[model samples]
Target: MLQRKTTKLINKHLLMSLVVVAFASTSLELAYAQKNQTATKKKSSDISLTSDDKIFLELREASKNNEASKAKDLGQKLSNYDIADYVAYFQIKPRLFDKGGAPRAETMADDAVDQFLKKYDGTALADRLRNDWLLVLGKRKDWPTFDREYAQFVLDDDTQVKCYALQSRLTKGESVNVLAAEVKNILLDSRYFGDACPDLVNSIYKANGFSKHEVATFSRMAVENNFETLANRFDVPDPMADIVRSARKSPEVAFRDFDKKAWRTSKENTAAAWGSVGQYLAKKLDPNGLKAFKMQHELGHHHLLTPETQEWKVRAALREGDWRIVKETIDHMTPSVRKRDPAWTYWHARAQKELGDESLAKESLQALSDQYHFYGQLAREDLGMKIHVPKRVAADESLVKQASSNKAFARAVRFYDMGLRFEGNREWNWELRNLSDKQLIAVAEHAKRIGLYDRAVNTADRTKLEHDFSLRYPTPFKESLAPIAGSIGLDTNWAYGLIRQESRFIMNARSHVGASGLMQVMPATAKYVAKKIGMNSFKPSQLDDMKVNLTLGSNYLNMVLQDLDGSWALASAAYNAGPGRPKMWREKLPRVVEGAIFAETIPFNETRGYVKNVLANASYYTAMSSNKTPSLKQNLGTVSPKASVLSELP
Candidate 1:
């Protein structure tokens, strides 16, 4: 009798669960109708919490703190949960990743890993499992299983795994040239690739893949790419590697080292030695660098000039505004180096214009005007054209409705509301991955309607068939922004532009470094700005509020602008980095140069990109808001030494 009563209760609850999902489905339709619906409503709450949710939360915390035994106990209680796969994963994670006091991961059965991958298939959890499983396989030198599993791996960004895959291929007697090309790219890039890349190359060397000449070529590539530290590691035939090393440490010492070598018959060694010295001199922008090049030319060793030395020569000339020399150097540049960026294209045109070659300059400018970048905008200005934001592309309502109904995106919206932005983005991107161009626009519109401005912009950026300027350059939070910017004497469009880049209009967005809200004001910065502006009763929590964030952010921007002598370029750099850095960087330049050149030469990768994007974004916003094209050059002006400006603020 008790068993029958329990059965009836289970059936009643099952019916309730179905009704909840049905209600959620109906609410999603309402969400479609009201674009401004709170992202968290119905979807998460509709799924009634059970003991499993509590246990799962506890298990997650335990795993995070590495309380393996505690996690195991909590995880056991979640064995029958709807996301039991995740619980199982947490149960196994510590064993796989932990080094000290952990049991052998190789003991894990192949069926165990295969089961997780097979069940989860397309989920982020599966991708994570693959990574962990691959690591264990690599640790055990189990190449066969790795090879089999690697084919199904998505997100091929793990450099170590890539290196291991290459090792497996080599062990199978396969040529690594195809992957070697990829490796070379990783090596030459400015980003760190960790130990795996060097390890792979070392393995290749042991396998007799790299000849002395090949190693020398790689070393040169490293030096040219400004990866001097990496270049030092290459096992090139002695004195040449030594010269590359000395080039970074002391160009004078490198020149002395080159001078010590007697170059009568060894032309290759001579070229290597002289090229290293020349590169060092050019890198320092030493006045003697050009003289060193002339000396090499006089001695018929100009052919020894590599792309590195040639490019630095262009930078040095650009600093001095030596247009004739700039054009000559550019003309002499290798096609690969000359065509590396549109900056060179713009410079090529400028050089032609400076040298009284208007026709040639016009041709170069015309080619560059079609692009949509810093140089592209400048090129358009050079061609006497206005920079206009492209028209909005209207997505089909049916397509948008379909996108709104995407199960993954719906779940993502719920996750975002739960403050699980990482997971939410993963789900959101998974849905975006296979979408058609039109579908992409539709989803972007859907994301926009739901207040996911960042997702909207990113999605619109991916569409190849459609160009949507309004979607890409959205002006959100005007109600809070306009008054704050106006009262602070800041350009409303510029303030909006900076905020767009800073937080992507996410109201509660917090950066990894603890910047919060739409403006991404750091806690200390918030306090400082509030104090300076005489804002009493300021609380750090208030930084997350829209109005307070804009108020503090605009005041700080105005401060930097005033401090930096009203140069927007310097001010933008100061805003992203700090006030001190832009000041120091300005001191590095002895004379005035165009703000574009100043921006490009910034040493910090993040700050350099930040300044350009903010300025370009500001230009677009200005044009969009005012319905008149603003000159990007006028915004950039020139960045000069603080001393050059008489009676400037300290």
Candidate 2:
């Protein structure tokens, strides 16, 4: 019985030993697999191609054949590779297109359309192609083809309205009155083009007979366009002339009472407010006084409105016995304000101490124990005495030097102001090139002094070639942009043009509406795209990094291009407006035409001119940027009116 029991115990021990060995072996195998996986991941992440890679091999084959078609095919296949591949593809596409001619290129495009339509039917590309087809049909003046295609594709009301107008133009001789009514209907539709009502009204007058009301409307447009001579033709005093005079007398009150409605209803009031301020300042100060005050005020706004600024302001005010401004400044303090305004608290404590409020002053001083304010530490040390020394933040000397020499930076500021002016008035194609280099440089320096760094950088870059100094192109990232154009299938000249128009290639470029980075991406859009591309960890600050910004911007642009059916015109429009608006316009093509006619009839001057300017710019850019310089006929497409059309008409 004892021998049997001992045998049983030995068997149990053997089983336990086998279990431990098995666990150890399994863990070792798992570790080996994990290491192998890590190696594979690293290889995949490299993105750099070797000589033996399929794309490189295909490129080699295409090179030997001297067959442009084969080369083009290989190039397209390699487009999924890194930026190097994209550059190679871009270089090859033009060569292939040049060699094969339009027919061959068109065939390839058609094949691509077919393949993409079949594979990604519901995607942005499919919609884009459909829109392109519609545009082509419209350009060809093939209304039947356009109508047939328009039926297949979904279009937004705005596009529909435009389509209808085009159709009406085509069928004008058949029933002039009917077509005119159609145009008028489109003009009245708010969804199609609510902003262009005035233009539509003028069109209506021309189509029928010009009346006194129509002449008045045309004169108002002239006035809005800054054509004082033409505007003077409507000699009737502005209905709100008295209101404008009243507002001029009380400029501050006018500014305070300014709202969207008031500005829209009374141009005289707006002119009065803006002109009055200039006149008042002119009277109050010397010739240079207004300019100097503007510079000083802008600088003060930048440096004195921040929490740190507020702290400094309060301290300075307390010392100068100017409590009113200090109190007004600190009234709407945020948490960031409290944290950054240690100097403010310190000065507040001093004020209390001066008032013989020892207890409150002591409490304020004690509060600084855990904080790291500029004046907090000093306040703690000088709690019992009057705090007099002001801590000054040093300006970056290199940055200041660069800013001072940057002419492009100055131009950007001027252009920005010009844009604002253009927004208020309906001026068209006001080019920045008209300004002198000296003026641009001065503006750049002024922007820098006022903390408009992005504008300063833009202006500086634009004036770089003209200036002999290296200070204009001080940013290292500017040098890195050479490879960016080719990588994105853009010509260097065109890229420069676009950048000049966009952000002047300033990596830290930001729009007033919170668009950030070189391409001015909105935060939400950036985040969405980053995640879509598996860059889940992208931070908002990365948008300011040149390489990252270019990569993401190119990707976003590709997406937009795809969405807009490869029409750079529509893509540019979508970039300005949201993609949804453009998409809706495309979907409701007929309705959109009506809406556009309606928009033309709109009394709102701003939107009327905005659409026209954007369209005109897009047309110009498209013609200028195409591989071949498009003919005037090609540029304007079917919309090009006959030489005598306008003259022969009304």
Candidate 3:
């Protein structure tokens, strides 16, 4: 029942299940057998519980429903439960919201939390409970208990918590200037880090830790990034904040309005404000705005341009293929700004090459080629070197045995076997914190032996001295993939490359947006492809079937590939970020641009990265499959607005 275009692909052959490369001789079946055996040997004998266990479930349900009388009744019947910590947590959690005044509620919550922490001090749930307790203490303004509990709180990256901690320090007459850098970082972050962060920013400004000029700089930055709520709270005057807000909808009017008020502020501050609006226009894909702004206005010397302004200047020039201007903008940036990010460093070298300064460009590329990243691969390509992948080293029995015996690793394995991957990955990564490079390699090898391909790839990436290409860039479903790709006239390496980036060989990996299976196809996309290919009675659930999913995914990819005129770079971007977005991005180009520059200028951060990684992965896969060096430049061929004859290929 396949459509004419797809019938030949399906009729070509049977499914192949054997993998091509063998980093470890352990097959998927053998790994599953090992997991089953381990589970059988280690499973606790007393899994089923007595009638008393029903009380625990009742208490949990009562707590969830916020039923105070039901919880109170269940609490009296739970004294004999073996899980004393959980029982205590379930009893106290609902009561933390008690309306009987703040101090009394906090004291009750604190006592219950302290008891749980005392009993289960090292467990993950204890830390989770402590966060709830800290929130109560923060609300009650009990700085003493809040400080003590906050100090003991691990994983302290919560922005709101840090803001409260700062409030406590400031209340005690501590100089906020001592934490100036940290304050700026947390305050300026784009995400709404909750009310506490804005409250902390207001506190710091009132405390004179942030000067008027500093406050204005942050406001301008907020407006440039279209964070209006943040811009409004920076104490900028209502009229000026209004002008900044207008930049999003009317950049030209915003720029003119900003100019009229230029003489009211200091020259440097005025430049900063002007730069913010200009950057906004550039980011909005206004082709002439940035170039005209630079030509007509005085931004002082190159070194005096704000980091934000310089970044937009470089981006605008790169978008228009003006290499000289790109080099000039980068040269004006501070050494720290230019040197910190590999993206800027790579672009500086690229500009140098286009400007016929190969000596300097070569030096920059040479230094960057040694690292592993999107830019590093580009640097390697610029230097005419193949992507260097280290030889696969087999794991020794002794190393494997040692890794299996490690307590934390064993806990992770047990968690994975119990279908608790979230907990398993957490335990696994947490244990990796203090491991030596050699120990990490051994642990990665053990993960590979157990068919934890995702863990194996991630863990192997951590090693400094040793490198293993086969483990890092594995082709897990080669037998099923190769013939299907060939039958469809698609590059097997390219298909594998896209799949590896999409799911990392995790068959059941579901994205946050519900993209499922090996190729991460959405249910709607699957249905459409299924119907288009004359597949009858197609159930959405068939997306989980490996062959069906690959058939639909590869066909969709090939369709996109042809529609975009055989440009893998565009097709890769199209696959991740839809076909419409890349077309719009291409239209923004003043003229046909190099694929690298086009990729670097993609407005969506995720899609930009997706295109680069997929192409780079395809290049490496090509090298591995053909046993010859693949040209990264050829892989990322120049993208143009016009379609090619390949678009007509059927």
Pick the lDDT winner. Answer: 1
Our tally of clashes for model 1 stands at 0
Regions of candidate 1 where Cα sits further than 4 Å from its true position: 1-74, 80-82, 92-95, 98-109, 135-144, 168-182, 189-195, 206-209, 213-317, 320-368, 644-650
> 1-650, model 2: which lDDT tens digit per residue?
00000001123222110000000001012211221111101113323445434454466446444456666666666665543422253333333233322112233344444454466454332444555444444444566655655665643334443644445354554454554445433332222232233333344455553343333433433332334454454433234333334433653443345433444643433432333332333222222223322332333322112222233333333323434434443443334454433545655665566667789778887786333222333454545432121222233455457545554344433323422211111111112234455544554455556654433444433442233112222223445655764666643332332333344344444443456555556666677667766788899778767777766655565566565455443343344444443343344222222222222212222222223233333333333344443221121121111121011000
User: What's the best-to-worst order under lDDT?
Assistant: 1, 3, 2
lDDT of 2: 0.39
**Residue by residue across 1-650, what tens digits does model 3's lDDT show?**
00000011112132111011101111121212221111111122323445666676688667656565778788779787765665677777676654331212346556667878988786655776777676667766678988999998876656667877888888999888965556655553435445566566677888888766666655665565676676666664323456556766787777777767667856555555555566667776777556444642455534334456667778878887778777877776666567656888899999899889999999999988977666888899888887866665655568779988887688777555544455466567766766776677778788877787777877766766666666666787788887778887999888887776666676765543446677867676677667777887889778777888888889878877877778888888777766655666777678788888888777654566567777777776777778777676787788776633212111
> lDDT of each structure?
0.67, 0.39, 0.66
Q: Per-residue lDDT of 1-650 in model 1, one digit per residue for the tens?
A: 00000001123222110000000011012212221212222235435555666577677767656566777888878767866677887776655655342224555446767877888898877887787677667666689888887887886656567777887887787876665655544443323433445556766766677655545655565665566676666666334656666776798877766676636535655665565576567555564555455445445433334555666666656766768767876786656567765667888899999889999999999998866667778889989998877666788899999988888889777656655555576677767777787788889899999999877877776775566767777888888788888887899888876776666677775544456677767787788778878998999989767899889888888987887889899988777766656676787675888898788666554566567778887888888788667888999999887642221111
Check candidate 3 and list the clashing pairs.
none
> In candidate 3, what residue range of length 10 has the lowest lDDT sum?
1-10
TM-score of each: 0.74, 0.27, 0.75
Model 2: residue 49 alpha-carbon error in angstroms: 48
**Which should have the higher TM-score, number 2 or number 3?**
3
Query: Which 10 successive residues of model 1 have the least lDDT summed?
Result: 16-25
Q: Give stretches of model 3 more than 4 Å off.
A: 1-108, 115-156, 160-178, 185-188, 203-207, 219-239, 250-273, 292-297, 300-313, 322-341, 352-363, 402-422, 512-514, 531-537, 643-650
Candidate 2, superposed: residue stretches over 4 Å from native: 1-479, 488-495, 587-650
Give the candidate number with the greatest TM-score: 3
RMSD values, in order shown: 13.3, 32.4, 9.1
